[model samples]
Target: MTRFRAAPVLRALVTLAVLGSVAACGTGTDAVVQGGTFDFVTPGGKTEIFYDPPSERGTIGNISGPDLMVDGKTTSLSDFAGQPVVVNLWGQWCGPCRGEADDLETVYENTKDLGVAFLGINVKDPQQDKAQDFVTDNNVSYPSVYDPAMRTLTALGGKFPTSVIPSTLVLDREHRVAAVFLKALLAEDLQPVVERVAREQ
Candidate 1:
């Protein structure tokens, strides 16, 4: 009897077909397509945008924000109020994280001068040493909470989505969700978004 080897090939085709269907939506959350809008891949990994630039585009949620521990100090979002804040979730082994590290640092350096707060959530990192080294090597000046179990992430409730490895959440000066980028980010991709929020009253 000839062995049935079509199953694997069929499964591969189906996977590709599903990805194509999502891409065909043309919403541009898929980094490959570039920004038509901000993408917050939620519960089912479906794309959603909670906010946009220049003005609030969607409903604002009641988020008390989370208090994450960094370097033995208790820190909360409230501590960064009165200015735009950027929260980035990343890990050591994530390839995209490495690629975007410099971009994040560059933007942070420039925007910090403008009083923007950048916080990093190091999630699911198996190797804390490697994670710290990554920050040191990349010259990441932002303070990051070590979240091997993602406690800080989960504690945020639905305020922040930690499902995306290199996700970024941009908050306006009012501390409301301004934009959520569910992909690896670049300095150029974030500068305008941050500046827009900073300019808001």
Candidate 2:
């Protein structure tokens, strides 16, 4: 996703407004809202993990869209049911996305045998070929949902960050969140997190 280019004052005011609203409602401390979509904001360099049991965790609904690399083909979150999934929201134009691509693939390779799955969500790239090229150049084996308008993010429920590029979510076997990383990451940073979720019974 594109960086927030608003002036510092404007950005601060907007953030304050959102925080005030969330606080007023006694909602989650991590909750953030923009363009009518709810998401968990990862203040820079921070990660969020959910330790709630499966019975208490919020589940992500199925999100479907065209395949980024294959025309006329589609992919969905439901396809990976009963497995731990690493869901990444990225854009071909984002530098962090490019930087993390190889690491993501590495983690995917290492953990797939453990019943771990990986899915990418390509967002805001109007030129689909650029997104396709990104996957090809990075040798990404997993499928990504091409969502130029980021519409698929709604399925992640109110706790998912729709506008954060390079953000990641680790879901448990039942598709409920186990961890969230809103910053760019390397294999060393992502592998253990996926493994932890994969170990969940």
Give TM per candidate: 0.66, 0.75
Worst 10 residues of 2 by lDDT: 28-37
Worst 10 residues of 1 by lDDT: 28-37
lDDT of 2 at 124: 91
lDDT by residue (tens digit), candidate 1, 1-201: 234688777889999999999878743211111112222335365443446554634322222222233343544555676878887889988999999999998888888877899978777876778888888888888777666666555433344566678888787776667777788988998988887777776
lDDT of 1 at 189: 88
Candidate 1 lDDT score at position 153:
55
Candidate 1 accuracy as TM-score: 0.66
The regions of model 1 sitting more than 4 angstroms off are 1-71, 155-161
Best by TM-score: 2
